[model samples]
Target: MKTPVIHLDVDRLIQRIALFALAGLLTIGLSVLGFHHWQMSDPYVRAVLEIEGDVSHGRAIFQMNCAGCHGDSGDGLVGPSLHSISAHKTRASLIRQVIGGQTPPMPQFQPSPETMADLLEYLETL
Candidate 1:
C-alpha cells in the first residue's frame, strides 16, 4: 500500500500568519483606546478637567505636597521625574495616579477637584 503525501502551501501559510498578526494588533489598539475613553469618562476625572487651573497656585500646591519626592523642579528624586509628564500621560491618567496611589511609597492624595486642577497646571509647566 502506498501512503499519500500532503503538501502545504507556504505562501498561503505566510499570508495567514500576517493576517492574524494584523488582526491582533488591531485588537490591542482598540482595547487601549477603549480603556482610555473609559478613564476619561469617569465623573471625577471629568469634573477635575472642567475646572480652570491657576499656575501660581498649582506651583504652590506642588511645592507643598510633591516637591519632596518629585524635586523642586519636577526632577526625579525619590519619585520619578515628572518633566514633560503631560506629554507622556493624559490628564485623566495623572488624576487617577495621584488619587489612586496605586504605586507604592506614594500615598493617596485626594485633593479637591480645584486643587487637583491646580496641581495639574503646575505639572504641565514642568
Candidate 2:
C-alpha cells in the first residue's frame, strides 16, 4: 500500500489568520464606539448629569401636583409608576405632557419653565 501526500498552503493560511485578526479588531472597535454613543445619548443619563433645576423645589412641586395620582414615591396610584420616568421619557417629552396635557385622567398642568425644569430634576432623582 502507498501513502498519499498531503499539501498545505501556508500563505493562504497566514492570510486567513490575518483576515480574522482584522475582523476581530474591527468588531471590537465598533462595539466600543456603539457603547460610548449609547451612554452619551441616553436621555435619563443626560438628565441626571445636566443641571437645569432645583431638585428640592421639584420635590415640593411633585408632592403638590403629582402625589394625588402618582403617590409619594411615584410608585403609582391613579397614574402609572414614575419612579423611572426619566428612563422612559425625555425632558422635552415631560414638558409637553405637563403643558399640552394627555387625554383623560392625566390633567393639564401649566408649570412655569423654572418649575418644569425643577420637576424634571426631581424626576431624575426618582
Candidate 3:
C-alpha cells in the first residue's frame, strides 16, 4: 500500500497572510484617526486637550494637602496609597470623593473644578 502525499500552495497562503496583514493595518490606522477626530470634536475631551495639566502645581497642592496622610510619594501613611488609585478608580470618582470629603479621619477640602482636575491629573501620575 502507498501513502497519499498532500501538496500545499505556498503562494496562496502568502497572499492570504498579506491580505490579513493589510486589513489589520488599515483597521488600526482608521481607529487611531477616528479617535483623534473624536478628541478634537468632543467638547469635554477638547477642554482637557486644550488645557495641559500642570504637574508642578499639582505636586505643590498634593504636598500641601495630601502628603500628611497619603505620604510624600502617596505610599500610604495614614491614608491609602494614592500611587495606584487611578488604576482602581476613575478620574471622576476620585474628584468627587475628594470634593465630597467622605473619607473618614481625613479633613474635607473644597477645591475648585480646575484644582480638582489638577489634583486628579497629579494622582494619575502617581
Candidate 4:
C-alpha cells in the first residue's frame, strides 16, 4: 500500500488567505474602538477640557463632594488645603489629579469627567 500525498487546493488556499486578511483588518478596527485610540485626535478627547458643568453647580459639588476634605474655604483637612490650588497647579493638572487620585491616602473620586472639570474650575475661583 502507498501513502496518499495531500495536494494543496490553490483556490482554497487563496480563500483562506483572504479570510485571514479580512479577519486581521476587523480585529484591528475593533481594537482601535475598544481602546479609543481612534478618537484620540478628536480634540473632544480629555485633551479638549470639557469642564461644561456650571460654576454654580460646581459650587454645590464642591460643598458636597469636596468640603469634607477641602472645607468650605478650600482649607486643608485630611487633604491638603486647596485655597490657592489654582496658583499651585495648572487647570489640566488639577483636573487630572482629582480624577486619577493620588497616594494611598487619597481615594479616586468617580465623578463624571464633566463634574471633575467643573470642580476644578470652581476650585480655581477659590
Measured by lDDT, the strongest candidate is 1
Clashes counted in candidate 4 amount to 0
Residue 13 accuracy (lDDT) in model 1: 100
Per-candidate count of clashing residue pairs (backbone under 3 Å):
0, 0, 0, 0
**What would you estimate as the lDDT of candidate 4?**
0.73
- Model 1 lDDT at residue 33: 96
Clashing pairs in 1: none
Q: Once all C-alphas are superposed, what RMSD does model 3 give against the true structure?
A: 6.1
**Model 2: lowest-lDDT 10 consecutive positions:** 42-51
**lDDT (Cα, 0-100) at 24 in candidate 4:** 100
Ranking the candidates on lDDT from highest down gives 1, 2, 3, 4
Is candidate 2 or 4 superior in TM-score?
Answer: 2
lDDT of 3 by residue, 14-116 (tens): 9999999999999999997886675457454444434556778888899999999999999999998887888887554565567667878777876655666
lDDT of each: 0.94, 0.79, 0.76, 0.73
Instruction: Mark the 10 consecutive residues where model 4 has the least summed lDDT.
Output: 39-48
Which candidate number maximizes TM-score? 1
- Give model 2's clash tally: 0
- lDDT for 59 (candidate 1): 96
